[model samples]
Every structure is written in structure tokens, then in C-alpha cells.
Target: MSDPYGPPPSDPQEPQGTPYGNQPYGQQPSGQQPYGTQPYNQQPYGQQPPGQPPYQQPYGGSGPSNPDERTWGGAAHWSALIGAFVALAFLGPLLVMLVKGNQSAYVRAQAVESLNFQLSILIYGIVSFVLAFVLIGFLLLPIVGLIWLVFTIIGSVKASNGELYRYPLTIRMVS
Candidate 1:
């Protein structure tokens, strides 16, 4: 059978070349400089290369992460309330801290703060529950719950707004 590609070019000295834009080595048509020979002072077209770390970029990255990252951190702070109502106040924040803590400092800080607060509330709740057997226990349990709810809401708001939030009553058990 005949080759569908019509055999190859037969000219021994005609110089093989790409049908695409490339014009082969040492034979660039008229004006263009060869690759990598850009003028010494010319900067690349977009995005400066990574080296010496720009004095201006903060947070040890090319630049601060986008706002969406901050939102995720904030959400982590708020999610602790879900655990609170479910009787596992540390689950949400603990999971977030374990899963995403290393990704961004802001997220890690929020997660840690939430976890600490939840743990403190857990301790307080246990104490209040045991004390409920006594005359004063009933009042303290409800008050603790109210305080937890209010503080969690405040922390969530501050985090969502990209502000640092430290739980006022947190005891730093997890640090």
C-alpha cells in the first residue's frame, strides 16, 4: 500500500522545517532576536519571578491570599457553634484545625481560638451539670450556655470580617 503521508521530502539540501511558526535554528527571518537574548533591562511581561522575596509581600507568600481564604478561616471560627448545640463543642473547630490549620496562619489562629473556647465551655458545662444536683446548679448551667452562645457569635463576626478574635473566656487548653 502507498504511504498516506506521500513519502518524505526528497531534497537533500532543502532544510526540513515546521509548518508552524518556528523557522528552525540559525535561520530566524530578518528581525527577531533568538530565544533568551532579551535586552538586559527588559522585565518579563507579567509577574516578577520569585527570588529575594519582594520586601513588600507579607505573610511569607507571593502576596496575601485572596479574601476567599480569609472567609474560610472565619467560617471555621463560626462552625464551633454547630458543635455546641450538638453537645460536642470541640468537634467542628478541632476538625478544621487538624485539616486546614497548616494552610494559613489566620485560619490556624481562628481554629485554635475556637477550639480553646469550646474546650473551656465543655469544662464549664460539665461543672455546671454536676452542680445542677445542688440548688444553684440550674442557674449556672443556663448562664454558661448563654455566654457560650453569645461569645461564639461575636468571635464568628470578628473572624468573618477578617479581624483577629480571641475568645474572652477561653482558657487556652489546646493553645
Candidate 2:
């Protein structure tokens, strides 16, 4: 404990190279240090230091980010065919999408398109059946029914594959 390292450090608690010189007497670095030991303008422990704000995640690294991306897929472009199938059995689903699903415009548009497709098929089948009965009676019933069936199946398949098809002579219900 002689002065081999130039005046031996004034405080035993502080390690070497503390720009603030020797730490306070009896006070250990773990317990306390001389006032000069702290950096200039530094605040006390458990307090916000000078200049810097508390650490926080960078602007766009992680954590819950965009609401749109989470709620709806990008563009929200899913198969409207699902809606069409649901509407065929129960019109309630289409109505639900029209009202609540409008939270995403893309979903709303697709739902409306699906309802329109189903309505078109129903109308075409009705009109064709009536005309066939009036003109050719029972003879054309099977032929007209077969044609309608073929077209409906084809349309459904196409829609399921994300293709938009317009059926002829169908009333427009949605813009």
C-alpha cells in the first residue's frame, strides 16, 4: 500500500482511469463515488439522465405495427367465390359482409360482387325456365335446365379461381 503508482489513489474504492480522479473515501464504486466521478451534467441514479430519452424500440423494427396489415391481408383479395357459395345456401353471410365487412373496402366489394353473381344466376334460371315452358312446353324444359346447370357450374368454378364473369341478361343489383 505504498505510493508505487504515484500517490497511490486518494480513494481505495475507485479503479484506475476514473477521469473524475480518486473516488470518495470509504465509499466503494458499488456503494457510492465522489461527486467528480460522474460524467458532467449526469443525473442521479433512477432518474432520467441528461440529453437522452429512455430506450424504446426503433420506429419500424418490431411489435404490433399496421392495423390494416393485421386485420386484412394485403389488398384483402381473397376468393369471392367463398361468399358466393355461402350466399347460395344462406343470404345472411353476404349481408353480414356488406355491413360489417366494409371495415375493409376490398372485402366489401368482393362480397357485393359475390351476391350479384348468385342473383344473376337465379334470375337467368327463372326467366329461361318461364320462356321455355311458354314456347316449347315440356320439350325444352330438360334442354334449358341442362344449359342452366352447365353455366352455373362453370361460373362457380371460374369465380372460385378468382375470375370475374358477367352472365348475360342478369339484373344489376350492385354497382
Candidate 3:
């Protein structure tokens, strides 16, 4: 039977020539330039074509966004603390990295994290050796102090390249 809304339902073979007939959602119409073709109004589902103008979209004529402005600040930051003048100066950088590492919000945050971890190990080693020496002063185990020093040196070398090492009985006083 037929109804009076308009023409009867067409056959499944009918062609849909509407702009959106063949185009997918959130896509621009084919055969049209991405930019300078349409007004700045709402684009077809707000889609931008490749190699367009104005470089508004990310990864375009102007390039992608820079997170930290590409600085070796991470290394410099840790270096200020680790590379020091006196023998105990190394602890300054190590401790600084560990305490302030979590606050790093840069592209090299991962590097800072690793540096901090390694620094912690170095500091622990130094402290352990010092403790061993103090014990030896009381006529106790002096060899343990020597062993701690050796291990600490190795750890410092490894840490220089950014590694993670947790020392036993260490205190994390800061974030």
C-alpha cells in the first residue's frame, strides 16, 4: 500500500547525491581544498585537510608544540648539585635531584627521575661509608667502610648515565 507523506520509499539502488552521502563523519567533502575554500565558519564536522594554510592545527606549517622549549635544563639542573668542588659536593647534586625530581615537568622528566634515583644511591653509599668509619673509630668493622666506598664509586659511575638504584635504610625526607 502507498502513503501520502511524499513519494513512496525509493529502491535500495537509489543514489544519495547529498554532500554527506559518501563522506564519513568528522571529515571534509572530497575534491575540495582544505583551506581558503570555505569561510571560517563551522567546517564539515570541523575537519582540516592535509597541507592546509594558517598552520593552526598541530604538526603543520608552523610545526608541533614544544613542551620544554628543547633545553638541556634537566642535565644542568642535576649537574649543579652533583658536580661540586669539594669531596662532599657530589652529594649536593644527588640529593637535589632526588628531592626535586618529582617537581620536574619537562620533556626530560624521565631523565630527571632516573638521575634522582641514581643520586639517591650515591648519597646512601657515602653515608654508609661514613657510618662504617665511625664504627671503626670505636674499634669495629673498618673493612665494611672500605667495601661501602668501593660500591659507592661504582654506583656513582652508573648513576652518571642515569640509572635507578635504591639504597637500604635510606630516608626519603622530601618529594
Candidate 4:
């Protein structure tokens, strides 16, 4: 009786000596290199081939090359609406700027514009709140709010259309 746990007996009709039957497990059949070794002319990992240029990220300073980039630029302007409800309107444009700013100059510029506008609005709102005690703020506050809404909507539309829109009353604090 054969041992149950041992290797199975070789077949009589099969020609086998090495572990791979025709060649040893670690050896290549002929002039080929070993499994993990690279040939003499092969490039190292992550490097460009002989005549090819290295990979580079696209720069969009002149203009966005694709619709997705335009969308991101537009988002930088419209995101202010989300933060406005919480009285932290700068947070939305600031967030978009930090996340996508490095990848595209168009997005960075739009975010900066939105951030400046929000900051200007904040300052106006604060002054209006203080003036409310004198009864003047009660009127100025609503006007400021209305201006903010209209300008933000216009900026968003312009950005979505692939044009840069500068808010008329925005202080250029952010650049």
C-alpha cells in the first residue's frame, strides 16, 4: 500500500525529472532572464521609456481645457450659497480653493474672487448690524443682503458660462 500523505507516483508514459517536468522550477528555458529580473536595456519602474517625455499635469492658467474643469471653476463661485445659510459664507469658497486650487489656476482665481466677495459682505453686514441700534442698520442690512444674493447669482451664472465675473461691490482684499 502507498503512503496516503506522500507525493503521488509518477506516470510511466510521462517523461519527468525536474520539478517542472521539462526544466527545473528556478531555471528559464533558454536565453530569458529570471522571473523578477529586468533585461539590460529595460527602464526602471515609473520612468519614461527611451524616447518618450516624462508625464506632466496639465496647467489651465490660460483657460480650462475641458468641461469638468469649467464645472469646478463654477463650483468655486456657487459654493458660497451653502455657507451663506450658516453665516459662514467664506467657508464654501475657501474649501473649494484648498481642495482644487493647486490643480487649476482657473479654479483658484474663481475661489479667490468668491472669497473676497464673501468677506466684503461680512464686513458690510457687521457694520449694518451695529447701525441697527441707530435704526439705519435696519434698512442697510436688508439692502446688503439683497445685493449679496443678486451678485452671487450673477457670478455663478457667469462662471458656469466659462466667463470670470467680478462682483461689483467686492473689496479686492483676497486678490
Backbone clash pairs for candidate 2 read none
Error at 91, model 4, angstroms: 0.5
What range of 10 consecutive residues in model 3 has the weakest lDDT sum? 56-65
lDDT of candidates 1 onward, in order? 0.76, 0.47, 0.43, 0.83
lDDT tens digits by residue: candidate 4, 59-99: 33556677877898788878998888897989989998899
Winner on lDDT (2 vs 4) = 4
lDDT preference between candidates 1 and 2, better one: 1
For model 3 the local lDDT of residue 125 reads 57
Number of the top-ranking candidate, with TM-score as the measure: 4
Task: Residues 75-98, candidate 1: write the lDDT tens digits.
Answer: 777788777578787888888888
TM-score of 3: 0.27
**Residue pairs in collision within model 4:** none
RMSD each, Å: 15.5, 22.1, 14.3, 14.8
Candidate 1 TM-score, true structure as reference: 0.61
lDDT of predicted model 4: 0.83
For 3-100, candidate 3 gives per-residue lDDT tens digits of: 88877776777554545466776566654556556655546655666577643321112211242312232342344345444534334445444554
- Write down the RMSD of candidate 2 (Cα, Å): 22.1
